[model samples]
Target: MSDFSATGYQPVSVSDPEVAALVGQDLPEDAFREIRDILFTVKGFDLDSYKDRCIKRRIAARIRQLGFPHISGYVACLAAEPTEQLALLEALTIHVSQFFRNPTTFMVLEKKILPALLRTRPAGRELRLWSAGCAMGEEPYSLALLCDELCNSPEQITIYATDISNDILKKARQGRYEPHRVAEVPDSVLKRYFTLEEGFYRLNDRLRKRVRFFHNDILNDRPFHRVDLILCRNMLIYFSPPQQEHILKTFAAALVAGGYLVLGRSETMISETRELFECVNAAERIYRKKADDVKEDD
Candidate 1:
């Protein structure tokens, strides 16, 4: 008998009794204090403000998978182990994303938001868009498709896609996807927008050139320039409240007057900071910056 409970169970080696017993334990007080300092030295982001329980579960998952004896050993491994550092980042970073992720949101943008913007775009000026924290390329690519549809010449629109993970950015830049991933794109649009290549569809160069991919930490990097719209979805859910507030303020500053902001369906602007934005589509999580704001925080 394996002595394992199947309904709520895992293998002994992968879930060693001692390690399972340690699940509820906090990272050693000193180790918790040191983690951010160490991670910042290597990864350039502070982890201290992340909710302890969230951090604990992620670290515990890693420890369990690797059969580490203690959080201290994991901390030491993070310092001395490059592979472990990458694994830690995988655990901490948000990777979940999809194309035309929420159909109604895209529907609203196409039906109302973009048409309104096109009506107002200054003559001879390009429409600029930024997809901050763009993951695996889906969201930004979807935006690119929208721009291509709306533009007189797709070349006139510029989309900047930025993410903290180099690995994910590389995948995004490739713009190749399994057929199932393109299911949301209507057949007509999919054929016109992408080309079949080696069992996958690749975003054509016209669309690819419209998007410029960059490795950027939204909290640390300079804001994208001449931004008419910014799409920063889902990525902020893991951030501390203060970080969220700072990012919203930063986004408000970055946006050109009347420029739109799109957040994940689950997110909302901090009401106390209402002076910076006016919700344009409350149900859709879209907002427009006040006319008075243009320059970003230094």
Candidate 2:
């Protein structure tokens, strides 16, 4: 998941000395475990899967803001107040995304990947794509726009977008975005596909209808099957190595043989999963699932 900031809360840096000091204080291990259990019981969020330093630092920042001197106090607050739990979950999991987030990655997809995949597709078959961790619908809508332009018929493509937060999924289904969220979008595309409403740019029904938004937790939920492409960007960095491998293996299983996987610019395929996929473009962090006929490395 990408970094999230609630209203009135400044973003916390993991390396900040203040956060370090807070975490370094009399925070007992059991208290931390209690906090994790409370979060799981209330929100179903597996805090243990996240990198300890990052999650702890974010919690520490919240603790600092709420004027709690220790982790125990915050644990009590979380157990007593459901609203605080949701606010913390939002702070932890919410991501702000834009249309065509990384131009270069989309350029690679448009110029190279899409053309190649379409050429190899059998006639009468639809191209399937999944945007995992799609926040606010921008990522999937961006894919829909690209597929719409490339394919001869809109029905020739299917786009599935999922997020863990039901509240975010509801917003994503609306297919509405602020102007800044669409700043990267070309003016021509903006005019053709979206309507300028009172203030927000509302996606036209054509593109809006193209995407299917759902609530999915990649960790515990079953993945979509036989997908042609999967875009899960900037999400793995927050997880521990084992959790990262688990998610990557899930992605690998979901993709068809020779299907593509595109990750965030900063993410890389972990060593444990390197045998499952072959790197296609290192610069853009694109990879292709190895065909079944290929043998794994010793």
Q: TM-score of every model?
A: 0.81, 0.79
What is the lDDT of every predicted structure here?
0.78, 0.82
Which of the numbered candidates is closest to the native, going by highest lDDT? 2
Instruction: Please provide, for model 2 over 213-283, each residue's C-alpha lDDT reduced to its tens digit, 9 standing for 90 to 100.
Output: 88888878888887889999977765667778889999888888899999998789997689989999999
Which structure among the candidates has the greatest TM-score?
1
Model 1 lowest lDDT segment of ten = 1-10
Q: lDDT of candidate 2 vs native?
A: 0.82
Whole-model lDDT, candidate 1?
0.78
- Model 2 stretches with alpha carbons more than 4 Å out: 1-33, 37-87, 293-298
